[model samples]
Target chain A: MRRLGAALWFAVHTAGQNFRRNLGVSLAGVFTMGLILFLVGGALLFTHSVDSVLQAQQAKASRIKIYLSDSASLASIMDFQLRLKNDPRVISVTFENKDQAAREAAQNPDIQAALNALGSNPLPASLNLNVRQLTDLGQFDSMARNTPIVDKTTATDYNPDVIGKLRTVISVISLVGGIIALILLVISLVIIMNTIRTAVYARRTEIEIMKLVGATDWFVRWPFILEGVIGGLLAAVFSGGIVFLGYKLFVQAAQRSLLSVPFDASYSAALLFLLVLGGVAVGAFGSYLGVRRFLSV
Target chain B: MSVALAERPIMSPAPALRPVISFHGVTKVYPNGTTALRDVNLAVHQGDFCFLVGASGAGKSTLVRLLIREETASTGRIFIDGHEITRMPHRKLPKLRRKFGIVFQDYKLLNTRTVAQNVAFALQVTRPGQRHLREKVEEVLWIVGLEDKLDKYPDELSGGEQQRVAIARALVHRPRIFLADEPTGNLDPDTSWGIVQLLLQINHRGTTVLMATHNREVVDLVRRRVIAIEDGRVIRDEAQGSYLREGEATI
Candidate 1:
């Protein structure tokens, strides 16, 4: 019972002293921990933003846009829309008459001038289709071409190149964020371990004194462990606070600038939990390792 | 000040209680084949203040180490409270260690802690309840007469003060017996007696004290139970005074 009481008091007392005594080191530890967590949180937010943005822009259109041959009749357009809608991947298809084409173009200044010069709705009618998901873009484009619309059907002006480039960039950023976070976490642990070791070295004389006074091995060791835990916890709290502020601001900026893209900036609870858990884990583990290594029998 | 043990014209011998600590033909050989102690037999009875006088390597340290359960003996059975300690496992060592307070010549007070912290550390480490730990620390510091210096760190105190803190730490737990290994080796003659006086005072309260030292004047002047050791064997054991419960040394 006495030993256990000693353990608890010593744990608290040592951790407090360690935090105070090693302020510079402790701050450095906190900074590293917070930065690592921030990186992780930031990457997750960005990925979420990307997914939300894609989700909001609307479902992918059927990979094929059908342009009727000049001689193709209205019956054939109706037949094509019906046939494509029944296909497994197809969601919906709409037929636009030549008059609708001329009307849409007349809204564009350059295209309207060209239409007025023609002085009539001479453009062929077309079909606009939407698909359920973007699965096999190449296969989708091929299926659209084979829709037998009795004319040439092709991909529209949606720019697949841009989407592809954005996806690639997101993947790289996520991969880089993951690597950096891992490296920083390892570095934080090392710094904490080293700090605890230094404290042990400083207290070696005190330990020898305890031994002479008939203080047991356990009695001598517990205070140092307590010190480590204290150091770790302080670092954690500091880092956690910084991460909370940073991500909040980041989410705010995202919401403001990317109004068209929907982003949830309300995951404050999860972020706080991550910070606290990280701090406690680092402190406890750091203390355990320091005592284990430095206080070896 | 608490009653200064008046100068005694003659001291009385303590009644012989059961030997608090007994070593039976104890022999200890080091891992390097250095025979530190060989066939040493000794006993320390309760309320008897005794000193083990020997040269540096006369197994004084090893024997003291054995007494505190710091190191075990090689070839002999030892007993504290009649319990065999020869093959005692380490997990049971703390309970045995708590039975006695061990002081050293260097006055091993924890320098990082204040005087109160050092004294309190003993009870605190033993896991006593908070109230008892505080009360006991205050009581022991009062006994050592350092209640005013509780906040002073070990480095801020004199050698005598540091030793007093160490003594307070040893005594705070109120062990059944006291052990000192050259407790006065680092102090001057005057400071040495002051510490000895404290030991004598504590012995008066019925706790057996076994101090190992080579200080001839302390041995002759105090005239308590003096046991001389040389070459791992007991040369003398004599009781010179009656134990007083809480008064000046009539012994």
Candidate 2:
């Protein structure tokens, strides 16, 4: 037990000492690691925000309005809405009577003028639907056209071109974000490994002497590994703080504009936690590999 | 510190039956096809003081390296304390190495550490939680005649003092065998003699000592056991020999 304590103390003490002695290289490693972590965290948060915004836009686009024939009875329209609502692909169904449609049209001056010129409630009652998937909108639109109560002159207002474009944009953004994150992670690992290798190289004489004096491999490795862990923790804390503050500012800036980007506190917290864990893991593994080559002596 | 070599304690002439270090047909052929040693055979008993006199690249360092398991012999076997270490597993190298204390030509002291810390480092790494670490360091420093220079760093000391610090670190653990590879190669004759006196003193305390050197003067003056290596082979083994054999050409 005492031996363990003494060994722990030596490792901790040596780690601190080495960190200070090689402050230039040490801080450089930490700085690079911090920058990479910040980039990763920032990219993740940005991707998530864009995804949510696209989701909201998708929800708005995944809707159809079926115009009912003027002669259709209220009971039949309500029955049609209930049937649409029961469909697994539909999120919601709402009935808009002619009066409600006219009222909504009145908010548009051109539509109100056209309605005044007609001198009758020309606006038809409509069934508005919110579907689960944008791709299913075409199915819903075709189904609406076959309904007997649906108006034949103008079918459901489902624009395939707009929905397809929106879907494409969402997929492209997700793909680009995923690729960027993967590339950044790979770069971070390589950079950390090289940086730790440099630090290990600087103290190779110390390692050689230790080995010559009969120190066990782990005994020599502990201090360097501990140094890596400490460096990793420091980088994570600094980068996590910057990422959190940057995400808040980004959300606020986006909100101030036309975009409605939400500040997902839980997701940010989770991402920060992952970043810290990644930093520590990379740091430790890098040091382990760096010291490995010198231990053979 | 200047010390008289002639005033050293008398050494025991009796040889232990079992050799603490022995080599049976040991050969080392490096990857680059440099045959460093060939069919070398020798035994160093306990409390023996032997000189390994050879020219540069004459396999002196290879012998030292093989004993510490820093390099494996390409063939044959080696035993330390009657245990064969040529084929010993990597995990057991540390324990095997603990049986020997080694020094190099460059002193190899940690320049950033104080004399005391440099000596204490061996114990800290090999025997953690060792009580009286300070006293132990002091005792070793005293043995190397550096008791008052505990707090001094290597850079602050002279070359001789620096070598003493290295000696103290090696002796701190009280290894059973001491291996010095060109320990006095970088020192003057006077300082080299002082260092040899220290090694002789260490051997007097019953630890086997093997010094690989190119100093013909020290080897001739000491007149102890001499193993001369020429062209990767031990050409001569004398119980009480000089740097060169009787009426022989250059070594």
Candidate 3:
């Protein structure tokens, strides 16, 4: 217990000394670290926002359309629908007969007169098939081709090509976000190291004296480590605060006023998680890198 | 190694009431292949005002380092209060050294802090309370006759005044052992005597004082136990009470 108290006391004293003695350098370190984390956090925000669109596209991907053939029998279409239902790729299928199709078409006054001119309903009976997942569209379509009664199958609900394109776009965004985060974290680390090195250089003589007085490696390193921690803490607060405020503005402006459909879900929780994590990560990484470079113990 | 230890000599007929330090053939071979101490065998009893005098590279500083656990012995062992100091680990060194107060030649004052702050740094690093630090610092500053200059920076002080501040810092913790390595090496003659007199006064209060100096004049003025070294060997260990007078001792 006494040893623990001594250690804590020493650590506190070291931090106090670092704050009082190296205030300017510590502040500079904090600002630069905050800027780096901000850039990283900004990139993350951009990727997350853009990827939501792609995620929704992927979530609602597969529904099928049946082509109308005037000559096709209702019995054959019913058999095909039953076959589709048995297939594991299909969730459910509904048959639309020519009569039903004609009645639905009658609701549109523009198409009604044209339909009335025909001796008999020219539209053929068709079936609608919906699948479990957008990614399963290929399998569902391939299975539809094997069904003997199905003449042709088309997807009316989800576009696979559009989803593919969106996936590629979001993938690129994610990759770019990761690279940018890595680069900015490196920058934060470099800034921390330089600041600590400056502090060490300025106090080289004092450190030497401490060494002469039998100060251990831990003792010598405490002030430098404390300086790094102080810088990191300040940077954490700044980055976290900015991220929070920016998130609030984006939510209030983007969700309620400007673009509503994409951001209907609550992003405040995600924003809170991101801000706190970015702050802590930036603070920890900066301190780790700074101390690793400048201190021995 | 034992043969060399037997061949070299620092051992003496020490009176054994209580020994503050004892070296049983301690040697220091630095990383760059320089041998600083070669089988040093010495004992410093409690309350002895010992002076280690030597020319440059005569192992005086290295001997001081071993006593304080700054550098461990390469070949042999040392004891402080009958405990092995040569094998002490780095973690134990600080607390062990907290028992000793050191006066360095360069005055080693923290330039960023005031005189009071620098004096308090020793106790503060040991993590005494704020009130105790202030009280101890004020008392030491007064002891060194610099109570009024507490707020002055090291750069603002003259050479003699800076040395006094360093002395105050060293003494503030009330260490049982006081080691001063060339403490008067930088001061003028009159200032050197002032420091020597202060050290003697400190010794009178029962702290074991070991000073390493090249200044023959200062050594003669304030008579004490003088140990002279030549080429990594102890040549003379003398009591300085009746051998010399104040004016006759010159650099």
Candidate 4:
């Protein structure tokens, strides 16, 4: 028990002393790790916000309007609407009669002027659909084209060009974001390892003396590991605070701009927790590897 | 082999006393294929003081390293206090090292720490929370005649004073065996003699001492048991021998 207490004290005391004595190196390590963590957190939050924005945009864009022929029966159109609503891919099906369609078109000045010039209501009754996924739009478009109640000339307004472009944008953004995050994490680990290695190298004589005097490998290693953990924790706290603050400011800026990005409190909290956990783990593992080569002496 | 033995005066220890350190046909070949020690056999009993005299690369350091398990013998066995250390696991090295006090020509003192802290460091690392640590450090400093310089750092002291601080650190743990590898290599003649006298006092207190050195004057004046190494082989072993063989000049 006494030996254990003494060993703990020695580890703590030495860690603190070494940290203070090598303040330049220690701060360099912390600052580098802090910067990398900030980048990682910022990139992750950016990707998440972008994804949420794209999802909202996709919901708005994922719609198809199926126009009905003048000779089609009202009962046949109603049956088609019901069938479309029952399909799992469709979120909603709303019928727009000729009068309703005319009223909606009148809201646009160019279409309203054209309607005013016409002698009668020429707009056809149509079923507007909200779909669950972008790929289902093509299926709905083809299904509407084959229906007898649908207009042969204007089957459905499902623009494949717009949907294809949006799909490509979302995929590319996610892939780039994932790649950036992975690269940053790997770089942070390498930098932390090298920094800790430099610290270990500076005090190699102390380690040699300790080993020569019969100090156990663990006894020698504990101080360095503790120092690393302390450094990692400090970096994480500072960087996490900065990231959250930046996220808040970013959310505010985005809200003031054209985008309506919300502040995801739960996601931010989870991210902060992960940053802290990652910092500690990296620090400890880096220190362990740094001190390993010297123990053989 | 017979001619080599006949050329030098060889005196073995008394067989009745079990040796504190014994090497049975020990040989050390480093990774680069350099044989540092070749088929050497020797023993040192408890409370014995032996001088290891050799050239720079004559395997003196290798022998010292082998004794501390710093380097394992390529082929052979080493027994420390009757425990075979050749196959001892790495985990048990600390316990094995606790049995010996070792010093180097460089002193190996932490320049950042004061004399008291430097001595106390050994106890703190090995004994941990040992009682009366301050008193033990002070006593050991007094033993090396540096009780007054307790608060001084290594840089503040001269080479001899720094060496004394190193000695105090080694002595603080009260190890059973004291190994000094060229402990006086950097000191002046008078200071070297003083350090050797300190080792003598330590040995007088019944701790075994093995000193590896090229200092011929100290070995001759003290006239203690001497073992000389040449070409990675033990050339001579004497009970109370000088640095050179009888009627021979160079070593």
Candidate 5:
């Protein structure tokens, strides 16, 4: 335990010393990591907001109306309404009687003129269904058509072509964003590895001397690994701040423009945490690999 | 067909007198197909000061490297203090290496660190406690006559001073054996003499000192046991020997 403590102290001290001594190189590494992380964070925020907007638009167009036949009884209509309400896909079901339908049509100027010309109530009672999912619309429509009392079923303002195009766009955006994020991650890893390699190369003699003095491989390697982790941590804090402020500003702008963006506090917190954790993991792993060749002596 | 040095008791009747280092038919061949050492057999007893004299590429450095476990032998076994180190595990190599302190021609001192820190580094790795670490560093620096220059970096010191710091680092660990690979190769005759005198003093204190060098004048002047190597073979092993073969012309 004592030896471990001493090793930890040495690693921490040396890591700090290395960072301070090579301030310019350290800053360059941090900046590179920050830039990569910022791009990745931006992509995440973009996809999340796009998904939220798609969901809001889908909700607006998910409503379907089932017209009741003239021979349909009130009790049967109520029973059908209860059955639809019990279905998980149905968000809400409202029953509109002939009187209510006629009243609503009279409120509309064009419908009122048509009703006045006809001189009779031509509007039929209908059951309005707001489905939770856009994909459930077809099943709900078929079920309503098969019902004995349902005259015909019509979905309100739902366009299959538009939804399909939007889905394709979302998938394409997610795939491209994910690929770009992965590339940035790989590039950042290589850069961190090279930075660590250079640091190890510069201190090659010190490493040799340490080996000659009977220092274990861990004794020599831990400092470089710690240095990498420190560099990554600095980058994380820097990039996290930038991403937080940028995302906040973006969400505010989206709000002002009447755009529905999904900006949850918990999600933002998780993203920040992942960025910091990823930075540390990449830095440590890179340093470990970089110093492996030098430790063969 | 070689006899083990551990079995031979001709050098001393005292039971405490043991071989500090032994090589029995040891051979080293690099992966690039260069044979550095060929069936070499040697032994150096505890408290013995031995000089390895040879030309460049005579396998002197290879032997030093093998002893330090930097390079493993292609065949045969080596023992240090009755322990076979030829097949020692990689994890155990560090513990074995702590038994010997090694110096190089380039001094290998960290230029970024002060003389005191350089010396203290050895102890800090092997033994880590601030109070004893400071005392040992001061003592070793004092022995190398660099106590006053403790805070000076390698660049701030002369070549001789730098070598002295290296020696101080090597000695700070209080190793049982001191291995010097051309300790004075980069120094002037006067500075070389000073470093040699320090090694002699270290040997006088009962540390088995094995130095690989091409300094003929120092070897001839010191008149110590010289093991001369030629083409990866020991051509001569004589106490109070000269640098070259008998009656050989000085190049």
Candidate 6:
């Protein structure tokens, strides 16, 4: 246990010394990692916002309307509304009487002018329904159409074509964003590996001396590995801060433009944590690969 | 002053003599189809000072490399301290290496580290105690006469000082055998003499010294046991031997 502690201490000490000694190269590596992580974070935020926007628009279109028969009794229509309100799948159901429908149309100038030209009220009373799930719409439509009080069921205002296109757009955006993030991750790994390789090359003589002095392979490798991990962690903290501040500023700007952005602070914090953890893991892995080829002696 | 090969009988030490190193029919053939050593048989007893004298490409370095287990023998077995290291496992190689102190022609010292740290590095790797490391480093540096320049880096030191630091690093572990591969190869005559004298003093302290050198004057002056190699073959092995074959006259 004491031996392990000493080894760890030496590794940490040498890692710090190596970092300080090669400040310029280390900074370059960290900067590259930070930039890549920033791009990934931005992409994540963009995809998340777009996803929420599409969901909100889809929610608005998902509302289904059922037309009531002209001869249906008011008591039956009120009973139907009360039954739907108790249904688990139904979010809310509102009954619009013929007079109320005509009044709402009269509020619209174009509809009011058209109505003034038409002599009698042609619009029917209807029940507008909001469902918990989009899939529940078809079942609710069948249920409403079979009812004696409902004369006809109008197809949902939700356009399948527009929904399909929006879904495609979302998928394409996510796929493209994911690909870009993956490419950036690979780039960061290569940069970190090269940086560590250069550091190892610079200290090739030291490695030779260490081996000659009977230092175990781990003794020589741990310092470089630790240095790499430290570089990655530093980059994570830097990029995390940048992403946090950048996202906050973006949210503020979006609000100023009267655009509602679904920014979740806890989610963003989780993402930040993941980024840091990823940085540390990749840094250690890169360092391991970088020093592996050199430790044969 | 002179003795014939037949007249100068080979001193056959008692079988009870504990050998620090022994090579039985050792052969080394690199992957490039170059045979570095062939069917070599030799042994060095404890506290013996032996010089390996040969021209370039005569397998002197290869011998040292094999002894240190840097390169494995292509054939035959080698024993260090009665442990057969010819096929020693990779995991145990480091522990085996700690038993001998190896120096190189280049005086391999970490330029970024101070002189004291350079020496302390050897002990730090094998023995893991900070307090013990400092004391051992100080003791070894004092032995090499570099106690005052402990804080100085390699670049700030002269060739002799740097070589002394390398020696100190090698000696810090207090190995039973000291192996110097052309230790004076990079130094001037005066510097080389000083380094050779230091190795002699170290050998005098009862540590087995195995040095590979091309310096004929130093070899002749010391008149120690010399093993000469040519074309991967041990052509001569003599006690109180001179550097050159024809100059094998006792001092």
Q: Evaluate every candidate with DockQ and list the scores.
A: 0.23, 0.67, 0.28, 0.72, 0.62, 0.50
- Candidate 2 deviant stretches above 4 angstroms: B1-16, B249-251
Across A106-198, the per-residue lDDT of candidate 6 in tens digits comes to 999999999889988877898889888666777877787689877754422334466567667767888887888888888888987888888
| Candidate 3, residue A262: how far the Cα is off, in Å | 3.9
* Candidate of highest TM-score: 2
Docking class of 5: medium
Residue B209's C-alpha lDDT in candidate 5? 100
Candidate 1 CAPRI grade: incorrect
Question: Per-residue lDDT for B1-251 in model 6, tens only?
Answer: 58875444334445558588998889999999999999999999988999999999999999999998889999988888877888898778888889899888888888878999888888877776556678788888888888899899999999988999999988987899999999999889999999999999999898999999998889989999999999999999999998987745534
Q: Which one is best on DockQ? A: 4
Distance from true position, residue B5, model 1, in Å?
A: 52
Off by over 4 Å in 6: A75-89, A115-120, A135-148, A153-157, B1-16, B247-251
RMSD (Å) per prediction: 9.9, 7.1, 5.2, 4.7, 3.3, 6.2
- Model 6 - which docking category? medium
lDDT of 2 by residue, A1-297 (tens): 999999999999999999999999999999999998889888888889988998888888888999999989888888888888889988998888899999998999998999999999988889899899988988888888899999999978877888788788878988888889889888988898899899999888899988998889999999999999999999999999999999889988998996999889899889989998999998999899888999987
Please rank every candidate by TM-score, starting with the best: 2, 5, 4, 6, 3, 1
DockQ measured for candidate 6: 0.50
Among all windows of 10 consecutive residues in model 5 chain A, the one with the lowest summed lDDT is A152-161
Worst 10 residues of 6 chain B by lDDT: B6-15
- Clash count, predicted structure 4: 0
Q: TM-score for all predictions? A: 0.74, 0.95, 0.80, 0.92, 0.94, 0.91
lDDT of 2 by residue, B1-251 (tens): 36665333323234457788888889999999999999999989988999999889999999999999999999988888878888899989999989989999999888898999999999999999999999999989988999889999999998888988888889999999999999998999999999999999999999999999999999999989999999889999999999987987883
**lDDT digits (tens) for residues B1-251 of candidate 1:** 46554322112234344467887778888899888887887777778888777677877888888887667888877778767776777666667777888788888676667888888877666544556667788889888888899899989988988888888989987899898889999999999999999999999999989888887678778877766666777665656521221253432
Q: In model 5, what are the clashing residue pairs, if there are any? A: none
In model 4, state the lDDT of residue B230: 93
In the range A1-297, model 3's lDDT, one tens digit per residue, is 655566567677777777766778767767787777677766776677767756765555556666545555777777767777997867888888779978987899977988878657866566777777667777766665665555544323346787677778878989998899888777766676676667667776666666555466666666566556666666766776786577557756766665543543346456545645654555545544545433331
Best-performing candidate as measured by lDDT? 4
The superposed Cα distance between candidate 5 and the true structure at residue A281, in angstroms, equals 0.5
lDDT of 5 by residue, A1-297 (tens): 777788789889988999899888788888888888888887887777786787787777788878888789999999999998998878899988888999987899998899989988877889988988778877877777788898754323246667667778777888888898899999989988898888788888878878878889988998999998998898888888999898889989999998867677998899899999988998899899889999997
How high is the lDDT of residue A227 in model 2? 94
